[model samples]
Target: MEQQRSFGSHTTGTLYLVPTPIGNLGDMTIRAIEILKTVDLIAAEDTRHTQMLLNHFEIKTKTISFHEHNTQMRIPELLAKLANGETIAQVSDAGMPSISDPGKELVRAAIDAGVPVVPLPGANAATTALIASGLPPQPFLFYGFLPRKAGEKNRELEKLAHESATLLFYESPHRVGKTLAAMQTAFGDRQAALARELTKKFETFIRGSLSALQTYAAGDLKGEFVIMVEGAADKPAVDVTVPLKMQVEAIVATGAKPNAAIKLVAKQNGLAKQVVYDAYHELEK
Candidate 1:
């Protein structure tokens, strides 16, 4: 395991992971501004987008685009600069770098190359939304964004459905409604919140059951969304004396669909969903 003292003496230049305001410019921290001003260069996810933030702060530090498309080519160059003792600060268009954004690749490269990787605390949409979500906060799983494809997304949601910690996700406005609907199906109508246009004049949050938020998402959806869902309730021990299929059938008798019952039984017994699914369908065969 490699240890690093952020400000400790190091031969190579440091890589600063700076965070920008998610929406409100006021959210930008003083230290973040100072780092951006002092760093030898700024590796931005989008040079044009970052230019606006720099213009606001009157920062003249030069910036280079280091987004997804060019990360493979840029990591070596950035590493070379760092090796030469040229400090660089990486920033996304908004919020912290590498949170559903581009920056992790360079961060890994920097660490592997023994360059000091220092992260500055600042704005982040997930935690910012969580505080006001009215859901349990400490134990949270921040799954930035789900897979875009339907099957992959559903399978991912199924895996997370049993988590006892609050779940966080970032979603585009256009797909937020569908995502909420999908969550409702996989995780039931659990408590959830949708925050959008965060820290901006039109900032808004819709809090309710997943079903309710899904309904609202069908309307005028605006801004990037931070979706927070309360985790699954703790499950009681399953009776080891009874068969797993019978236990699943008991849940189905309570008005739950067969698949939902199977999933729930699997979670409660700490078994794989597919295992419970096969057991439950044995009678059908």
Candidate 2:
């Protein structure tokens, strides 16, 4: 149990979670700049990348490297500084720290040590793309960067297939097409939008069905990508008591291929495909 009074007087120093610009440096907030200027130390995901931002703003505060590779070793050192009442600011390469970045562990450690953690509002690629996505804005899930492996990505998509809230994801230029294609298979050609190069001069948003976006991405996949997918339409309540084998049969009776029926039944019932396959085959026999 940790209590945080952001501006309260405490013996320990506060940890500021500062958000950097996702692309455009102009997106950096005034408060973020002030905090960066005054903080005792800045723990940046990429010291060299952050140096450019610091130089642009003329911020002279000292900085140290704190990214994925060195997080385990850096946490204890950062925590020690915080314990010594040295205010520390954590910033990622872009956007808010710990939002698909490298500040979560340090923040967790600071909280466990009873240190205050304060977050400043600033530029975020996910939310920036979301507002202009032309899809339902509220009640969206920000899933930053899907798994790279095909099977893992498919399983993750399977879990989210029934979600009713708008879905958001970050993908690299190289993986955007493949990710969109996977989304098409899992979600079945839902309304989708792809936002790329956000806040930069070449920013572009492509809105259409998932299939259409996949095709568009295939041609020229450059710049970072933020994908916003319309939610699964409100499905009528399903009867969970129905036997898995019967569900497969019903889908098959509707002219769906046996293999496709098994997959559909497995997804609907939240059962393994093998389980549904075995039951369906036994029913056939």
lDDT (CA) per prediction: 0.91, 0.88
Whole-model lDDT for model 1 versus the true structure?
0.91
Best of the candidates, TM-score = 1
- In model 2, the clashing pairs are none
Instruction: Point to the candidate with the largest lDDT.
Output: 1
Across residues 1-285, which tens digit of lDDT does each residue of candidate 2 receive?
Answer: 545788968999989999999899988889999999999999999999999999999999999999999999999999999999999999999998999999999988998999999999999999999999899998999899999999999879867877889999999999988998888767677899999999999999999988788789888678988999998777545578887778877755644456666877776777889989989778453
Clashes of each: 0, 0
Model 2 poorest 10 in a row by lDDT: 251-260
Model 2 scores what on Cα lDDT?
0.88
Cα miss at 218, model 2 (Å)?
Answer: 1.0
On the 0 to 100 scale, the lDDT of residue 285 in model 1 is 36
- In order, what is each prediction's RMSD in angstroms? 2.7, 3.5
